[model samples]
Structure formats: C-alpha cells, structure tokens
Target: MNIDHNDEAIVIVGSGAGGGTLAYELTKRGLPVVVIEAGGYLRNEDYVNDEWEAFNQMAWLDPRTTSGSWRIARDFPNLPAWIVKAVGGTTTHWSGATPRFKAHEFAARSTYGRVDGANLLDWPLTLAELEPYYDKAEIAMGSTHTHGRKPLPANNNYKVFANGAERVGYKHYSTGPYATNAEEYDGRPASIQDGFNFQGDKNKSKWSTLVREIPRAEATGLLDLRPDSQVVQITHDPTGRADAVLYLDKDGNLQRQAAKLVAVAANSIETPRLLLMSGSPMFPNGLANSSGQVGRNYMRHTTGSVYARFDQPVRMYRGETMAGVIADESRHDPDRGFAGGYYLETISLGPAFLASFAAPGAWGREFTEIMEAYSRTAGLWIVGEDMPQESNRVTLNTSVTDKNGLPVPNVHFDDHPNDTAMRDHGYRQAEVLYEAVGSTGSHRTPPYPATHNLGTSRMSARPEDGVVDKWGRTHDVPNLFISDGSVFTTGAAANPTLTIVALAIRQAEYIADELRVGGI
Candidate 1:
C-alpha cells in the first residue's frame, strides 16, 4: 500500500496528545492529514473496570515493533512503568493530572543558575509566548482546573505543607492550571471530583486527546486515521529533509506515506528511536542528527509515593487517578539546596490482587495480614521535577529485539545527586504530611523507577543544543518536526499531557503557517 504523491495530506506518526491534537487542529483548518497510530483505536467501552485490566490497557500488547517493554527500567526491576500505544496512546490510561508548567520552569538556567552535569537551559519560547497556546489547548481539550482564581485544594496532606510554607514565609499557590475540564466546555462533560477511588466509576467528562481530538479530526474529510500501522523509518531526501515515512500495515504490507511535512509525535523514548532508525547517506548518524542530539538529554518526572493506613477508611477509592493536588511546592528554590519542585497529590490503590504485591512484609502470613490491614489505605504521590541530562540518554539496543524484530530502546539513566536530594526532601515532606493527617506507618516507595519519560529530543534556539527548534521543527531536517514530550527542555513536576497538548497546538499553527506560505 502506498500513498500517492498528490494526496495533499500531512502524515503524523503516533496519535497521542501531540499527534492527536495536531491532526485535529490541522484538519479543522482544512488541511488534509493522515494519522498513523501503532495501536488500534479503543473506545470508552473498551476500558475495563478492573485495575489490572486498566493497567494492562496502558501498554501495547504486541511486544515486538512496539516500545511497550522498552519503558521498564533494567537496573531496578520490580517497578512497572506505564506507556500506551493505542490510538489515544498513553492518554487513555494517564492519571489525568494535568498542570501547566510554571513561568519559571521555562527559564531554569537563568533563574537558578546552572547545575553540574545537567543541561538546564532557558526555553527558546517563554511562558508568555506559550500562554496563548496553553489557553487554546485548555479550550480544545476541555481542561477543568481553576487557574489563579481560587486557592489550591486543601486536603489534609497539602494543608500541612501549606502551613509549613506559610510559617517559613515562602510564596505558595495552588497548582496553577489543569487541562481536565473544570466545567463542561466544547460539548465534553464536567469533571467529577470524588475522593481517591479512581477505579470506583468512570468519568466520561475526563478529556483525553484520543476522545477529544481524534473524533474531531476524523469528522473532517481532510483527516484519515490508519490504526495499527507501525512506522519503521523516515525516508529522507538528498538534502537531509524527511519527505515520507515507511511503515508496515497490520497485514504486514509495506507502505510509504509521502507528506510535504511530517510530524513525529511518538513520545520521548520512541521519537528518538524512530529518527535513529531512519538512517541516510546525508545523515549517517540518523535523519536530523547533524548535531548528534537526536537521542540526548533524556529526562523523566521522578516520582515517589508515600503510603499510609488510616484507622478509618478515607474512601481510598473514589474519583480519578489524581483527583486533587498540592501545587504550593512546585517551584525551585536554590536556597533549599534543590533545583526541582514537587506536586503532591493522592493516588489510587489497586484492587486486592495487585494490592497483594504492594503489601509490606514477607510473602507469608505476615504479608497476608499486612495486605488485609491496608487494603483500604490511601496513598500520596510526590511527582518531582527532573533536570534533563545529556548522559541520561536513549539509544537503540541492537542486542535486544522485541516481537516486531525491532531494536528496543536502551535507556541509560541515573539520578543526579541533586535529583536524589530533591526526591528525599519531597519524601520527608510527604511523611510530614502523613503524620499531620494522623496516619501511621507512612513510608516512601524505595527509589521510584523512571516512568514519565521526556526530553530525549529537546527543543532549543539552535541545533547545537537541541534536536528541534522552538517551533518543534527539526533543526537539521527542515520538513521533519516533532510534537511530544521529547521536545521539552525541562520536565516540570506536573503531568506532561497538558504541556504536550499545548506544544502540539503551537506546532500545528506553525505548520499551518508554513503550509500557507508554501515554505519548508
């Protein structure tokens, strides 16, 4: 199967937040767009009520050709990192905790100086530059949280941190903004706020880019979605410009999609892998690898969870994955000896079967007893900021191949000393919050394995420092663009979906403008 040269469609790979939003935005403006998603399309009915099933849905079942297994951290083996491959990508199973990156987050280098062994730099685009896009994304995705309108939510855990911050005379505010709908907008339902029981009932109002953008994009005849099409490589022209992508359809047929512009929306880990696989004479390192920054500067939002069992059941199961969050601490303070901020929030507890594995104590009668005791316990998560390091990188492991006979992403990452210190500080603060809430047996998960991956192809002003420019266009390959977490220069403490959507929306405008002008 081959797409004709005259198709007049922009080909987008990976239909997650970035690709999905791009497809919607472009098609709405009457640009023909072809979206290729490795994962099949799934509907709300496809979501199972069971925690294990829900967790499993977070990944692509086909191990080969997909990065499903590549997300796991090899060094520390027990933890499971979640990423999705379906048309919605990871947004389907995402915790739906959407918070905007702070204004200072975009200028970490200038604000806090610099850190050793880190590539902290000011984004080419400032918060004010992206603010309009953020608002556009919020409107497009039906974001829910109140921005600077009222004080942040005051759960028992956040109250403790707020009081401490107040006593210390530090400026603290609510987690600024969220993409989940605060009220019904754009025909999407309102966000329902229950306690910690996310598995209790499904909230249809929660806006996932899949549910929000894909449908809108599909309604336009300009957009066509091809699910289960695994892209193998990008085809580049002699000048090192990507002109098309080569992929395999579900029937194992080779297909080449030619587009004047190509956007790689695969997430941080896979985006770089795709580029590296697309080798050419003009780009021996890889397509768009003139600076050798294709797969560098890897980062993930390092997270730590503090668990506590209350005497009275706090209704541990209730609403979304993260219903309420404490944003007062989401800022970097060099005086505190750390360059990271943390967003603290409550998390869902798995059902009995999965809870058995998380339960403390040895795998004997003691473990069983512990499981019984904490079955209804509530937990808090400290999603902390991570500084992007060039060394903590993603490279293709030729020795390892998944089911698709493709090399898996070999991720090499270790927490920087300051990162570890920030995590420790956040853990101590979480312990304090638990104690303040009158909970016993509060403890942090031992060194969380990286899951929220970002920054593999960081965006900057120049090709020397990053893979993409401020507009998400590759510096080396002018026609090739990236729209995903991979373009982030810094990983904020917040869940990255909202920011990813905002950036994709911003990229869409740039692409639309370039198309209008017939410019590369």
Candidate 2:
C-alpha cells in the first residue's frame, strides 16, 4: 500500500549502512517506513564486475567541488568523495572490514587530554554502552570470526601481507572480523572467492544493506521504497518541529511526504547539505544549527596506501579485495609520534585502478614499469583517526548547482598535523614490513577521494555544542534525527560502517520506544 502524502509516516533518507539497517529494524518491529533514495536501484544480478565500468554505473558523479590543501583537490577536483549514489548507497562498494571501536576511542578527549588544533569531544556514550548493540549488528551482518561465524580463507595477497607483518613483529594479524562469509549463514551463500567484492558482490557472499537489510525490510511489506528521489527541503511547523519533506522524483517533479518522524542518513556531506538547505524563519541558521555546527568538523579518516614489488608472482587480485587486517598498530600510543594509531589492511586493486591510483599523473616509463609489475606486487591501505577541525567543513557552493538546480556541497579540508604524522608513520612501518619479507621497492600513494566521510552533524552532550544529542535526535528539532556517520563525535581508528550499523540498531530501539509512548 502506498503511504499517502498527507499521512504522518516514518520517513528515512538514503539507503546505506545506517538508513537501510534502520529501515529493516523499524519495519521488522511492525512499524511502517518510507525510504527515499537519491539513486536508482541496482540488484546483485545487476552489478558489473569490471572496475571502471562498475564505478561509472554506481558512483555519485554529481557536480561537487573540492578545496583546501588536500591532494584530492589536485587529483580529483570535482569528485570530493567516491561514494555510491545507488539505492544501497556506498555499502554496495565497501571493502567489508568490520572492526569495532576500542573502548578508549569512545573517550578520546578525556584520554588524549586536549590536543591543539583538534575538535576532540568524548562520545556522549561509551563502548560498554554500545557493546550489546555491536553484538546484535555483528550477528545480523554475519560478521566472520564473531559469534560463531568462520573467517574467510586467506588469499595470496593476505599470505604475503601476513608474512611481512610477522617478520615485522606485529602480533595481531588476521583474516577476519570481516563481514564476508566463509560458510553460508542467514540464507546468504558463502564467498566464491570473487575479487569483485568492491564492485558490488554479485555472488551475495559479502554483506551490504542492499543484500541483507533492504530485502528483509521489503519482505515485511511495511516498507515504501522509492529510489531515484532526491530530497531538497524539510518543511517544519510553526512550533519548530519537522512536518514534511519535499523531494524531486525521477521525473524532476517535486513531491512532499508528511512525516511524523524524519531521519536523515544521506551520508555526511549531503545530510548536512539537506539540513542547511532547509533553513527557514524558525531555523534561520539551519534545521539543527542553533549551535552553528551543522556542516562543521568534517572528517575523512587519515588514509594512504603502500604497494611493494617482489620477485615472485603474488597475483594479489585473485580473491577478496580486503580480507586481511593487521590490528597491532590500531592503538592509542602517543609514543608513535601521533595521538592515535592506524590499521594496515591488505588491499588488491585491478590493473586499471592500480595504474590510476599508483601515481595520479606519472610519465611513460615509471608508470608503465609499475603496471608491468602488477603480478609481482602486494599492497595495503593505511587508515587512521584524523583529527576533526572546525575549519574542515562542507558548505554550499551556490556557484555550482546540481542537475535539479540545487546548490551542491563544496568539501573543504586540510590535513591536520596529527594526520600527517600518522600517515608518515604508517608509510615507514609498511615499508619496513615489506622490506623485512624481501621487497625490491615500495611506493607510497596519496589518499584517494574519501570513502569514509564522517562527522558533519556531530553529536554532543549539550545542545550548545552540536547538532544532535546522544540519541541522534537533533537538539533543536525533536522529531528530526540523523542516522548516519555524520553524527560521529570522533572518527575512531576502526572502520565506520559497523559502528554506523550498530548505532542505527540502537537508535531504532529508542525511536521505537518513543513512538510507543508518544514521547516525540
């Protein structure tokens, strides 16, 4: 049944790890949900395995601008982020590494004690508070090496990475905490060892909101899923509560959906863009920008890559793209010349991507030489906590409008000193690891356009400090919420997808209870 435009229904935006999971959780509990996605739906059978072809089919290639001193500006000026715009969102393109946030990471401000040039804040809650939800999320996602799920087999790339890690004296290296299955669980089949995991898993072994949460939510018959609908504005009543959302359908016609409760999970950049665009007389600054913090404090985790060439043929791109993780460095030791630590995970890209990302603009000999050594190469990615700065932010660039004539978000970022230190350390350590296991040479690649965009509409303990509260409810608008990584207080050293899913699960429980008691 169609949810009428006048009916007060539960509405969610986007369909990624957060919004898609929240949709399933709420619908499974007998609540009706309407999910409006900005892109068209592409099923598992619809995925294209070729890297560049798949990228073109799924990437959010909208008109966006990038600024500040980040290398991405020089390399990919119009593509600030490499997120997917399809119905499942970026979850369709993630690497499937699901590491939990460490306990100390939740209390970063209290533990680190005031680093200069950082907007550090302790999470309103703690790891202990979220552990149970993490467990639930893990079980729901069928995370390997957790709750009786078996880990995926090690590929040649992981074998090489593990040997190097072992020679370097790293203790905690593993094939898991990954979300792909080694054996069938929860009706999804085991991995067929496909290297196209990054291009949307056609085999359905990897976990994505598209493969799991969305289908389950649809099965409940309580979901109204509308793809290719871009939300433009959230209209509010005179009492300052969100009442409706106005969006453009696939036909470019505007439609309004009345919402009793609205949850925005449109990733970090667009979530705030929508909120900022919704400014009215009641909320002159933005919907939840009473604290003037709607689009401030943007973070894309500190990232880079190290690829080494060896004498033997590793053929790294023969199995899962990112199945191995080295957790020994994922700690908070200031002795490492940085405030936080990083993870070194095995990664293997197709030859086309390897050439493109190995060196953005290199010449004939050096570039071709690297491509020629593809079979003999092994690589890993460095992902660490990047300090959030109030200056690094997403703002409206009215000069460049999107296809629908809306101002696109301009992402401005400058690497924090801590981020630089951590990246340098990661590079040195990766080189050492490769050398210890016999590498001829290694190349350090600058960060790609961000996939882990986070923290634009952060959560705070007090209303004056942030946009949302501990429950993800906007401090200025009670019925409005943010159910994505945009609400991250601090980006922990681990990946954000698992945490995003866990938070959505926890948020769903709270929202469901509030709905029952008429609390909103």
Candidate 3:
C-alpha cells in the first residue's frame, strides 16, 4: 500500500469531485493512486454550521485576482470563485442539486448557431454516450428522483416556489433529482434536514467526496490520499510524456512523486494554473497549450437570484439550501433572445449571506428592509448556460504570488451579449413567477463569485480546438489527463456537479483499460 516515488502509480491532483471519484474508481480496480490535495482533511463532524465561520474554515482563500466588466469585479475583486480548499473540494460546499444536462446542450454550436462574439463549440461526446455514466454517478451519489430513490420532502421555500411555478404555467417543477437522501441509503444516514447542506453536510446524508468516495477509496488500501500536499508542477520526460510531479508538503518541504500518468482535477482555475506553471522548453506555451486553448473559453453559467418577500413567514432556511427546481425554461429557443437556456431553482442563504449578497453595496433603508423581511423571503437562483468567449480566461499573474511564491491565477471575464440577454430574461421570468404567488416585493441579486467554474480546458474532437480529447486525455500529452469541469466544451443549464462526476467515472474506465493495454 505504500507507493514509493518510483512506483507505477497514477498521480491525481486536487481531490475534489473528479480526482476523489477517479481515485476510488482506479483503486477499486486494483490500480495504485496517489491523490495530492492542497488542503487539510476535515471530516463531517469538523464542519461548522455558521456561515461565515464555515467559509473561513473550508474556503480556498488563497490569493487570486479578477479582471472583468462583470459586476463581480466591482463587488468582489479579489475573490473570483467560492470553491473550497479542503479534501472534498467544492463538493463539501455544493447545494446538492444534480440535474443532468439536456441532449441539445452537448451540441451548443449546432443547436444555438453562431452568435456574435461567442466562442461556441460542440462537445466531443453526446448525452447518449454519457447516459450510463450519469446513471452510475447518480446511484453513487444517491440522487433523489432517480433510480427509484425517493425525493426529498418539499420544504416551505419549495412550496412557495413550486406554487409560483404552477401559477406561471410551467410544467416541470420538482423537489429533486437532488443528491441529498430522502431515506438512509449507501450506509449514509437520511438527511436530518438541518439546513446546513451548504456549509458542509455534517449529517453525512448529502453526497460529497469527503463522506463517500475518499473514505471508500481509502478502505481499498490502494489509495495514498495525501492531504495538505499542494502540487506545483508536472514534469515530463524527454519524449514529452509526463513522468513525475513536484509538490509542497504540509511542512513547506518540496517533494517529488513519480507517476506513470498524471491527472489534474484541481478545479478549472487551479487546473489550468498548474498546467501553465509546468511549462518547459519542450512545450513552451504550457503543458497542454498546443491549441492555445488551455485557459480560454471560460464559462460560469450566467447566474443571478430573485428573492421575494411575502406577508406570512416562509423561513426559506428550514430544510435544504437548494432542493426544488423548475426546468421549463431550460430548453433552447432562439426567440428568447439567447442561445442557451437556464434553470430557476430554490436557494436559501443564511441571514449573513443574504444581506451580503442580496445587494452587495446597497445601504440605508432599502438594505435594512431586506434584512427585516428575512423570515418571509423566498428565493430562487437563475442558473443558465453562459456563452464561452475566447477572451474570458484564467492566466498566471506573476505579480501576485501565494505563500509558496507561485504565481496566482488571474481570472479575466467579460459577459457575452448572449449572457447578458439570458440573465435579463431570467430576472424578468423570476419576477413574474414570484408575482404570481402574491409577493409584496422582490429584489434582484447580481451574480456571486462563481461556484460552477468550467471550460478553461475544453474537450474537442480535433486537437487544435481544445486541450483534451473525448476521453479527457490531453491532446498533446498522452500520459496527462484533465479530470475536472475544465474539460466541458460548453456550459449546460443544469448544475455541473453531476456531469463532472459522470465524466470522472467514464474517464476512470478508459484510464484503467488503456493502462491494461499499455497504451499510455
């Protein structure tokens, strides 16, 4: 079980949804894996329910710079994303919504056609090709409203949201396809309905790599899950094959771990950052920058929120943070003045987050009134497909360095015309939905630091168009793979965690088979 530096082990960076799941899958198949994670391991019992305290404890607060015309730049200039630096990555902080991507979403270029200033591309694979893996991921996550799993009970927030949806003439509204448990399954207990699903599910009922995949992988005795080990660079051999990795251990010591193959799953921002940092004479642009698409075409899913206040108390923060979803608007319609679609899903923030994010810099009576009406507020988030732009990207900012003296990632974004139109349509539709439920007043919240960061290294059938191929293997480096949301060719309307899990599952199978045949 002790994999030495020279052992034939697969080194996976960033133990999030992708790396964590891939570690388990490969280890379960009798392959040795070394999972290098940047943050320390925090168990379910270690999670704090308080919002601000939990954010400090689990968030990746390392130095990052942002540049864009997007409102996030004006509001939260330093924090470009709200992902975790813990063992489970953002899965510990996710809302547990697990909606699958629509079939048309895979072919965004073909379905939506070309829009001005949008860099749209069709995915290498289709929904049909990933369906079986989706099923496997859903079952593994114990997703509600799928595979005979009972749905989570509708809370008061969902009741109001669903009622509004029905009144608005929407057809599909449900309390699930969510990943939280309705009853005990997979050895994890049923949800206690503690409403702390966002601040790390302490109950162990919600699916996260910390609760499920990492522990299972550890049990196999083939996974060397090294926490607090920050992977810095991937080294390649003379023939351009990745051979080893250099990382900073917990005590600030540099360590080298040899690898038969390397898989980077360090989220979209850090994944591209690591690849860019590994640049050498053989591959000057970056490790996988033969297409110059290593950090281009970034998509954060055009996002916003609508919070409505009612006469009676709604107590939106009673059960799950995100459970109910209305999928009627997730269809592609050119008449909507946008290329891709979006989803209106229930979202409840604690009083602190609501006050801070409902309106970032508003003051005086308006902000105070929103705080006072917290008990009677029902809110839903607008998550839709944001167009990929060639200019929006993550690049290394050598001016700002982290504690390790490594350059931090500078995320630059600009809203495409399609993104702006889609967000506006979503806000109007959300107001209509809330109005149908007799809401006294409504407030529109601008997009927060993105939780769903995707498509810096996209998948493409041709090598010149993207960083990875259909199997997630980097087109330039046969022994290097990108096992994260960065491989998404286009952002879909659905929550991205489920698709990320499915892709990791499929990637694992391919990796194991290729290894068996000595192909990489």
Candidate 4:
C-alpha cells in the first residue's frame, strides 16, 4: 500500500506517543507514512537502568538556554524540557500515568472565569467528542484499570502512600490507571516492579510507542521509520500548503522528504522552534503563525515535589517510579486559593536526581542529613494545571547555535500568580498528606526541567487565537498539522501522553477521511 507517484507520503515528525500512534493507525488503514525522528532507534533491550547512564543515553541533552523567574532557570539553566530525543520520545522516560481529563478541564475558559494575566482558551473539541478516541487509545495503550487491564500491584511505597491518603480522607487514591502492564496483556509481559525502569523500562511492561506502535507499523510494511532525522524546516508551495520537510540526517547531511501532508510532533519546544525557523516571505512570522500564537502561550504544568523522612525505612525507590496518585486535590476549587487544581502522585527519583533536585546548591549538615536519609524518604510529585501566559514562550536564540549552526531555542517562562498560588497550595497539601503518614519532616523540591511541555502551537476554535483547529490541522496551512503537546489549548492536571495518543488517533481518522474526500 505504499502509494507511488509524484505525490509524497504522509510525513510525521517526532515518533513519540502522538506521531508513532498516528503512524501505526494510518499504516494499518493502508495509508503509507514516513516518520522522521531526531533520536536514535534504541531498542527496549538497549535500555540502561543506571540513573545518570540512562540520562545520558536517552535525554534530549541539546544546548537549549532557559531564562525565566522559575527556579529551573537558576537550577537547570541549560535544560528547559526533560523530554527524550528518540524514536519513542519522552514515553521512554514517562511513568505511564493515564488518567483522563475532567470534562470541566476542557472548557477552562468558561469554567475557570477570566483570570487576569492568563491566556485561557477552551479547546476546540470537547471530552464528549473525544471520549470514543480516548477509549480507543486506552485499549491500544493497555492502560491499567481500564478496559479490564489489571491494576499494577501496590509496592511498599504505594502502601504507605495509600494509607496516608485514607487517613487524610482523600477518596480517589489508587495503584493505577497507569499504562504499564499489571498482567500479561497485548503481548507485553507483566511488570517486574523493579525501581530502575522509569529511566527507561527495559522489561517492556510499560506501554511506549517504541515497544508497541512502531513494531506494529513496521510489520504493516507501509510505514518508514527513520531515526536521527532532525527536521529543521517545513517548506511549502506557493499556495502555502506544506509540501516537504527539510531535516538533518544521521550523518549531519541535509535531506528533504517531500510530504503529501506534514505533522509536527516535535514536543513543545522544538515544534515551535522548527516553525519559527521555517519562516517564508508569505508567512514571515512562521509557517503557521498567522494568529501570532505559534510560539506564544507556552505551558509546562505547575509542578513541585515533597519528600518526607520517616522514622522507619520507606524504600520508595524499590518499585515503579510513580506507583500511586491522590486525585482528591485534582478538582476545581478556587476557594482553595487557586484557579486550577493539582494531583499528588507518588514519585521516586533515584538518589542521583534526588540529591541534584532535592536541593540544588545547598550545603551543610542539613543537606547532608537529607542525603543520608535517602532510604527513609517517601516522595510525591505535584502535577497541576498551569495557566497559559502569553509571555511564557520558546524562541530561537540567535546568540547561541547548535552543532548544525542553527539557532538554539531559548525558553522563557515566568510563573503566573495563579501558578505560584497553585504550586504553593499543592506543596502545603503534600506536606499535610505526608504528615498524615506520621512523617518526621519533609522538604519541598522545586520544579525540575519540564516533563509535561505543552501549548506552544495550541488548538483554538478561532483562527485568530491559535495555530491549529480542532483536528490539529494548522489554520494557516491546510496540509500542516501539530500532533504533540504543542497542540494542547490548556494544560490539564492529567499527564498529556494519553491525551496526545488519543488526539493523534482522532487526527489520523480525520486525515484519512479528508484525504479520501480530497479535502487535504
């Protein structure tokens, strides 16, 4: 089904949850696709369990500057996004939480009221409209506790965490809704409950595109998965329809892949940066920057962490990285002193990351004491909805260039008052949550480099508001699309991967149907 002729195949950039899922879906439907990824095709067996070793192996450690009022600017000044630059993208490093977005979260603009200094916009599509796709994505990903996928067994960390949740009167605490397999399902084996998997799950229990979609797509024989192909520019014809993608191959040689349609799923930072770098005379600002919103409204979820030291050993790092989540706080209660909400997820950072992130530049007996009590520490991450500020954005810094002499991206973020308030509330709630478990004391870790980068080319109902429409097709260029978190209109409390896959599945259907009808 590799349709031949003058027209190019559908080109999908960045083979992560979104792009990889789209490739499998489209190819399985008899449509040919060419996926170009910037990272190497590291297999499941090639994964390293060591903290720093895995970090070096899979992280997108390119030169990107950070400048903002956020602590990450002062702490991790060189790394803005903690995403991966491989075939599976950040799915390789994700904890596999797959909770769905609440209905109200979709209509943030209408529900959250007009918050000052926030560029809030309701998504072009609703959860009700996407519910079927969400179901499909869950089935495809084998999300635990969904579609009869068994819940992952609770380890000691979750046992401690759940007991605390119960004592604190939080109702929605559980072992899963995660994508990692609890039992043998979909040809993937059950989890081994090893601590080192989060850096990169070698056992293949975690649902990642590299483990699932890419193999299936390749088996279909209609998909071409090219690794180490860093797409730099999206070129267009005179009519402003995306016609081809120019990328640097593995050998650092320039190459161009003609495209019948183009989908940019290059995470949040690189997606907008690529667009800005591809500016043409027709679209001076960027390829799809007609609304001047391509690089604006950047959102990384408001995040923080609380680690507590108990009298006895908790050994939090003995099981899955994020084993339990307390969802009681993930609600719209502005009376709690914030417009949005956050979830308290059980998190475990290996000693290396813990020491580096727990206290960036601290020294003394107190810091040494915290390090010494690593085995007795229990950790919980605060993941919350962050306001999309017009000022928080990803822009190319011409002052700094990459290996290819291209301008490196400069991420600028200033926490909104709402973000600050919500983070503070989350920290307070987390400390209290830990206290419920009879913890001696706790330390709140500042936000690390962003894991859930979102909304750099957001979806909006109006052309004047964003880069893409409901189906992820760019409003300015009909054939261009955004298939990653970059298309998120508002950053919801839930992790974005499940939604990204769901949206990509829905987008594939839309693109396939449109192609059949000559709409594209």
RMSD of each: 3.7, 1.4, 1.5, 2.0
- Native RMSD of candidate 1 (Å): 3.7
Best by lDDT: 3
lDDT of 4 at 211: 92
Give each model's clash number. 14, 0, 0, 0
Task: Estimate the lDDT of model 2.
Answer: 0.92
TM-score of 3: 0.99
Q: Give candidate 1 misplaced runs (Cα > 4 Å).
A: 1-3, 61-80, 147-178, 181-183, 191-203, 352-370, 447-451
Location of the lowest summed lDDT over 10 successive residues in candidate 4: 1-10
lDDT of 2 at 325: 95
Question: lDDT at 281 for candidate 4?
Answer: 100
Taking all chains together, each candidate's TM-score versus the true structure is 0.89, 0.99, 0.99, 0.98
Per-residue accuracy of model 2 over 75-188 as CA lDDT, tens digit each: 999988999998889989999999999999888899888999999998899999999999999998888989988889999999989998999899999998888989998889
Question: By lDDT, is 2 or 3 better?
Answer: 3
Per-candidate Cα lDDT values, in order, are 0.72, 0.92, 0.93, 0.91
Q: Write the per-residue lDDT of candidate 1 for residues 334-420, one digit (tens) a residue.
A: 677788688876665665533433533237764554466564456667787887877778788897786678887766666777777
What's model 3's lDDT at 126? Answer: 97
Q: Residues 266-363, candidate 3: write the lDDT tens digits.
A: 99999999999999999998998999999999889999999999999999999988879999999999898888799999999999999999789788
Tell me the tens digit of each residue's lDDT in model 4 across 1-520.
1222435599999899889999998999999899999999999899887899999999999899999899989999999789898889998889999999999999999999999999999999999999999999999999988887788889878888898888878999998789998888899999998987789998999999999999999999998888988888999999998898888888888887888899998999999999999999999998899899988899999999999899999999988989988888889999988887888899998888898998799889888888999999999899999999989999999999999999999999999999999999988887887899899988999999999999999999999999999999999999999999999999999988999999999999999999999999
